[model samples]
Target: MNTDLMINRGIIKYNGNAFEEIDDVIANEYPLTIIVDGDEFATMVCTPDHLDELVIGFLASEGIIRAIEDIAALSINEDRGFAYVELVQKQTMSKDFFSKRFIGSCCGKSRQFYLHNDVKTAKTFMKQIEISVSQCFNLMTKMQEQSTAFQLTGGLHNASLCTKDQVLLSRSDIGRHNALDKIYGYCLKNKLSITDMMIAFSGRISSEVLLKVSKIGVGIVLSKSAPTTLAVNLANDLGITAIGFVRGQSLNVYSHPERIVS
Candidate 1:
């Protein structure tokens, strides 16, 4: 399915004086309702691609499932926009499950409250191998370069899990968190180690983003954006290195800067 919807638009460019009419391709927004064990879990408005990965990663982020093996059955119907999942173990969720997120160009952020499940599942990542300044720059560049969708629609967020040298897996979505989730699911499904890896993101690092990073158990995150105060504090508490504003030649390291060198 072609997820880009081309439409006519009159838009202005950055530092431009006038608007011009042109054909524009916008990333399609689809509502996908995830049903877990016959129960409606969440309805995520997202780019209609990688539904399976999105579902898996969402569940994991919510502290519902840990590994791909934890899912006994899973099916996605993109046309109807539904994901049916059966967990291997009996599942339980708080009564306030409705408080869960419906976040980005979508709702735009995860739930503000830190739930008990998040506390139980979110890990304080251990020390990782040193990442140099140049390595961080290279990783962000590589992640952005791989974001073909963002380049096309200029409407998607990109995320990647990377070793110091290169990106291991990358994903992009209308929602920044969703893109990160896809990368998380990819790493889990591939049995890749999360602790030593870093995430390269194309969005601001908020508390929600930091929580996702904590849950994903990555020690370092690099973004060509900024981080919130709460997120920086959380990163410090969790022993995670949060780097942001990774443009051209300089970057800001928010917390746990020991893991970065040069």
Candidate 2:
């Protein structure tokens, strides 16, 4: 098994001419293939730590499984980084399953693999989680402090999910989406309730991200960057809260302002 490694790079100057050598930490990347009922679903380049959770979360985000219990068994080939999942009962895989192989996005959610129906049911829940701007900054600070990889390599993106009490889980990878998938998988495997949580990403809020959060029933999403217009529109239509450009003590609420407390 490969362990986390630290690498030393050249020097960089901060505040003055004084320079210091930088050291970074990162995990190894491996190809993880997901096979459902003996058929290939999707393959991702991810850290090999959470193959089972990644598979379960990927399936759930894709709308392949309605509930976490719908999955019966998940086997991971640690050596090969392959996962084979067996559902409790077989349901027809999406017709566009093959399409996922080609359509890749920078972050975790893929528009090419979206369901035809709109997320109308998500609009009914009027409950919103109010968080202060400083709290958003604090959460980001916590996320940054938890990112051992970025502190070292500075090449990977990180994603985390947090509740009012604390941050539940975080994952880092070269692909932002893969990081988010890791968190999703973690929650599914641990049987955590996602309805009362908010997701945080180191990337922009695109329609795909909104779609994934809505699918998981997360009421709010916060990002350290901007959001696409489609994402804002979808969040409003689905009654989800979208916060973006979250850095320091500021954030923009692009949709569902009712979720934010003044």
Candidate 3:
């Protein structure tokens, strides 16, 4: 299925004076219901591409699956917009999934408090991957150039896994978290080591974003937008190098500045 559609030609008004008919590419959004071992998991509204990766990534991030081996089988029916994931071990659903929280593109509804021990044990990344400032800027540039969906619809978030010089993988979705999940799923399925990798995102850096990066043991995150105060604090606690507002040749290092060489 196509991820975007050129639905209709419409007259676009500019500057309140001139108008022209233009073909608009609209990004597709749909509800993808995930079923884990016949139990209905959460349904997410996202773009249709990379459904398998999204499912695997979501399960992994939720701590439902500790490793790729935990997933026994996976099937995605795009026609029905459902993903069936069978795990090797039956797991209990997280309480957060059933709580009443307003889920957003960046942060989910619940405000989770992480204990120091919990952060240190499960999510803290202590990798020593140092990237130059120029490399950070260049990685952001590569991510931007690879965001074909965003350029086509101007209504999608892009995320990428990268090294110091090149983007290894990129994914797009209407939700920021979904884009990152797609990348996560891809890496996990391929057994790629994320310890020394960095993530470049075209969205605001939020606490949830930090958690996702931490879950995959990625050491750095770069964003073309701002970082929330809580996100910065979490990055510090998680030992992640968080850089935001990356444009052209400028960026603001929010945490662990030592990771970005001069």
Candidate 4:
């Protein structure tokens, strides 16, 4: 966790019927407005750090751009919390599309069905990435260990990009969508392929999260928490392996159990 992402605040603690005043740190919630071609695309509420990654991931997931070359001009005003972007080819989005995106941009909220762009961009993975049961458990352990922001504020969700054998990158944010966006954006900016990779998450798997993995071309998604019924269904439909309850030695392969060997 970056020091800029958290702040110390005075708080009260009640333990064993005793009240005490203490200082505590809390994660900073930042709302960054994304302006594209001088028009507001959407506003994302997330952790203060990784503004660039957050913007990139959000745009990529929303089917705005497939590669970094699509962006012509990009600048972030962190002090004012705004990201201005100009695409190489200006995209003409319908009013309906922008409305849907604005409403569904937050972490706690999501649209059950795919957006128009999602239908065009969402991937179906027929390829399988094999992982053992032990590997899944170990990966979850590694993700937890790297979730420093969660340990600090206890108010953030973590998202990690990993292979069958090792965790590669981990990002945390106050919003589940933002956390995944951070990692997803990094991959996009760096030109990394996620088709052979997976995501280890600290939050529950929702349809939104599952769809994100699908868009990112990740074959597998592992989470410490449970998966929603809709998420499991979508994962099965998209040919993705959705695993949950990945704690300790036991785990549940909600969909695509075939990918989990041993």
Best by TM-score: 4
**Cα-based lDDT at residue 29, candidate 4:** 86
Give one digit per residue, the lDDT tens place, for model 3 in 81-171: 8999898998764535433343334353122454322232247778678999899889998999988767877888999999888999998
Selected candidate, larger TM-score, 1 vs 4 = 4
Computed on alpha carbons, the lDDT of every model, listed in order, comes to 0.81, 0.70, 0.81, 0.85
Local error of candidate 2 at 166, Å?
Answer: 2.7
Model 3 bad stretches (over 4 Å): 1-21, 93-112, 115-122
Candidate 2 local lDDT, 155-248, one digit each (tens): 7777889875467788777766667766777777777777678887778887777776776667788888999977877777667888888887
User: Which one wins on lDDT?
Assistant: 4
Cα shift from native, residue 262, model 1 (Å): 0.5
- lDDT score for candidate 1 against the true structure: 0.81
Question: Which ten contiguous residues of candidate 1 have the minimum total lDDT?
Answer: 103-112
Report the number of clashing residue pairs per model.
Answer: 1, 5, 0, 0
Q: How close is candidate 1 to the true structure, as a TM-score?
A: 0.86
Clashes of 2: 5
Q: If both were scored by lDDT, which would come out higher, candidate 2 or candidate 3?
A: 3
Model 3 RMSD, rounded to 1 decimal: 5.0
Which order, best to worst by lDDT? 4, 1, 3, 2
Which parts of model 1 have CA positions greater than 4 angstroms off? 1-21, 95-113
